[model samples]
Target: MKKFLLSILMGCSLLEAAAQTAFTVNHGPYLQEVTQDGATIVFTTSRKAFSWVELKQHDAPEAEAVKHFNSKDGLKEAWNTFSLVRVEHLKPGTSYDYRIISKEMRSFQPYKVVYGDSIATKWHTFSTIDPQKRGGSFFITSDMHFDAAKLEKLLHAADYRTCDAFFYAGDMTSYIDKFEIPFTSFIDTSVKLFASSVPFEVVRGNHETRGNLARTYSSYFPKKNGKIYGSCLLGDVMVVMLDSGEDKAENHWVYAGLNDYDAYRTEQAEWLKELMNTKEYKKAKYRIVISHFPMVMSQQWKDEKEWVGWEDAIRKFLPVLNKGNVDLLVSGHTHRYFFHEQNVDGNNFPVLEQGESSAVRLELHGGKVQFQVIGVDGKILMEKTISKK
Candidate 1:
């Protein structure tokens, strides 16, 4: 009787271990940093220890117009559990069918990290939001790095469901250590709340400077530039997104001999000069630069890590926009939203500085811009209105 009882207990233990292993990987693949190119649905996905991963662009949620793709180095090696893949040149305002496949793990790796492991476990559909021409209102919120307690408190504070579109300026995940799991959860919540209905352009923040953070960032945002520094047009604005690549003093690649700040500036300087001359930019009524690092100093210094030599580089970058008649420079590292105005070449260019906060409320009409910084409990922290002379 004792031997028989012991066998059952051992069996239960084995069963529990298997269940735990599967549970870690079984969560639905989270999607965020959604952007649309024509009609294609471009977003990010992360899963664990699945055998194979492939992306198919389909007419229906289940049908296959598979525009399949593989990872950078294939999937045999384990980088981060997150992966990014984009379906090319889709139609405008169309719905897309996508599947993330996770096959059982083989004793050996499969397809280099291809479809072998870490993919969406099921099919999900995302609709592309209309472009600037079909102009509409979208919401901008920065620094919602998740804490269940904090998120729950803010969720209970207000109704955030009214906006037609949503934008995340950066720092989507607060955890730079484990790197994968936390970021995945943040995206899942946004999607669960139906925030994925419209296209969102995500910027790369300094926190994305961790080991597999870039890989994780790339995994979920494959559509971003092979390196995420470039310009895109959204409605009436010319949006220039720059990748600072973690440039605070101690933690950036600059400290590790990975990047030369001056060379990077020189390389991007050329692009900045040329892109400013592009037809879309020259013609657009609004030109905005979305960076993870704010263009100015924080309200009060907190620590050494909070300061970087970015101001010098930004000073170099701003002149091009000043010459090009750019309208606004917006960022979210300070966790506070502020609006300032400066004269560039005798023309007024508004500087909107922001840190990681909940949401920013703004309205542009009749060539006037007014922004309201609304915090928890409906308290209005700051508001500014700009009138064109």
Candidate 2:
């Protein structure tokens, strides 16, 4: 009887151990910073695990897939919940199918490692940006403020699958108090719709700078040069994304002395100066700047005192952008739509201030860029076109 009782207790312990080792994907498997020959795949796991990505050309056989792990020097990234595996050396404008694989690490020591259950996601596909290809379309939206429903509506209204890239201009959430807020507020919705296969670039907004996890933003949306502001060549267009920091001054009481945007803007300005001189920027047929705040606001807000960040942008960034021969500046912050014409309010380029209710689709073809603002009800609210610069 004693032996039988001990056997039952051991069985229960084994069952519990098995249950604890069950692994699953928590969020992401989304594409970010996708370039002509490389892309970063980010995802999180339910438990500490070693993660990797299996990738192959879309038309290739499964047996031809290559496994990629996020590693440095001689060590592979392991014992972590978040996984960021960057796949490189891909062909330009090529379609590739990929999936994430994570194995739970039950225990790890210098001489021994125990692995548990592993998980692999269904295959997803994405196409790398082709710098030489002319005429591609992209969708842009901002200030959803964590309204997943609204974001989904906008994405559907835009028919997002047909676009080469999706740009979240800023403020997808009101604030990110926890790490999960990104996945819960917007990323999860995106993965459900198109993020697993389509590369989405996030431009930082003022509100995103307000939460505790704000510093971790880059970890999720890694960019070139390790900064939020940078330029990417998508198709034939050069898209420059800028980080418009908090709306108030750095020393504002509400910030509790944590702000330093004044200097940050200066740093961006210096970077912009050099970027404009780069061969990539100068050779592009079209250029668009995505800034959360309109550096040079309309005449109506020219004297507004509440926007110190805007003032700083005008003083620091406007001059560099003007000299860069930017064709358009797309921004969202005021929740009101306004199209400022070129040479208006000290801006050499046209500025499109997209409202919260609409998504802007910019199509480049026939030497012109056509802009259509689609509303939540799936109706076109505004349309405009600009010739190549």
Tens-digit per-residue lDDT, 1-389, candidate 2: 99999999999999999787568988989998899899999999999999999999997998999999998998999999998998999999899999998999989899999999888999999988876799788899999998989999999999987887789889988888898888887899999988998878899898899888888887888764688788899877899999978887788898999988988988999999999988998888889899999867665666667777778887888888889888888999989777888887788888998889899999988778789989998899989998656
Judged by lDDT against the true structure, how good is candidate 2?
A: 0.88
lDDT of 1: 0.55
Candidate 2 residue pairs that clash: none
Which candidate number has the best lDDT? 2
Best by TM-score: 2
**For all candidates, what are the clash counts?**
27, 0
TM-score of 2: 0.92
lDDT of 1 by residue, 1-389 (tens): 99999999999999997766552333334443344543223333233443233444545434454544444565442333433344556665566666555443334344443334333445666654345453234455556665434443333333456554455666666545554444453555555565334445567666655543445565454454455567766556566876654555544544575445556656776788998877877776656666776555443542454455465456656666568665556677777667666652232477665545455655555566666666666667777766643
